[model samples]
Target: MTKPRGRGRPKGGTDSRSRILAAAIEEFGERGYEGATIRSIAARAGVDSALVHHYFGTKADLFADAADVPLRPDVVVPIILSGPRDEVGERIVRYVLESFERDDVRRRGVMLLRTAVGGKVGSPLIIGFLTRELLPRVARRLDVPDAELRAELVASQIAGMLMIRYVLGVKPIADAPIDELVARVGPTIQRYLFD
Candidate 1:
């Protein structure tokens, strides 16, 4: 006779996590971040809702994994916001450049950005998550009336630069040294943040 399974995820279900992630990607692509739920993902994966939590902890965590994004907004936002106000822009630029220095991170970052910029199946979901997760935190930190707008402008600048330099492999930008890029682009980011 076989033993009955427990109430949560199936015991010894090694493929369960990957199945959930695949389901999550599909659910998020169809429903977007705000709309997708753990229960839905679990259902799609043919597992109990508790199994989703057991494997991924939270919806956001699952989203990050499903999206294959290396950087987490919750982690990155704090780092970018913690430094000196005047040097915030430089810090942001440096952070992006440094993060991309890793081949694995660059591959995932480029894929995520490309999806968002190209308006692919999950573009709005990715962009919305990033903007929603990032912009409010930045807006709360800024004293300006147009804090949200400024934050968006900064995001656009960084996104455009990344696309040109990394995705498109444009000359000068792609070839430029990290420090030089930081020196030149940092002020622009600063201006957007505080000016």
Candidate 2:
């Protein structure tokens, strides 16, 4: 007769991937992206460091997966670019707000933002990800003389809104309806992208 199979997950009772992701988030949150290491995450997850490499090839990829952002720049940038140039700003703002409206996404975003703002190491990762990946793509699509500058400006505005509304939980702005925010902020973002 064959030996009986173990109960629960294949490796003990824990789901390795999920545990790794949770550990990754916690490590990144506490140590920031720069400081967080696969070994540390693995230790936290109760897995071998090789498991992290097996699951995610690179640190950046791991960070992206751990973040689990609802509105990924790769997805949003193309959508914004597909529309009329003049409407790009408004579309971007609307997309961001709409994405954040989802509880799961918002929670993840808020956690990431909090971690990002918590330390020297985390902030740079967040900024670099935005500047390097998202803004440049949008700017390239805009094809304007000062596309880079415009993108930076737009990022500033969006970041501010995110901080005030979600991070800080400021009363008026946080409490305001999505439509109201879109109407108020959309025009400025449009001007930044177009004008």
Off by over 4 Å in 2: 1-65, 68-71
RMSD of 1: 8.6
lDDT of 2 by residue, 10-128 (tens): 36233688878888877775676778899999888887787788888787888878776645677768877798876666687888888888766676676588767876645776788
How high is each candidate's TM-score?
0.66, 0.69
Reference-based lDDT, residue 39, model 1: 89
Model 2: ten consecutive residues of lowest lDDT: 5-14
- Candidate topping TM-score: 2
Question: Can you write out model 1's per-residue Cα lDDT over 102-131, one digit (the tens) per residue?
Answer: 866675566566556554545765667757
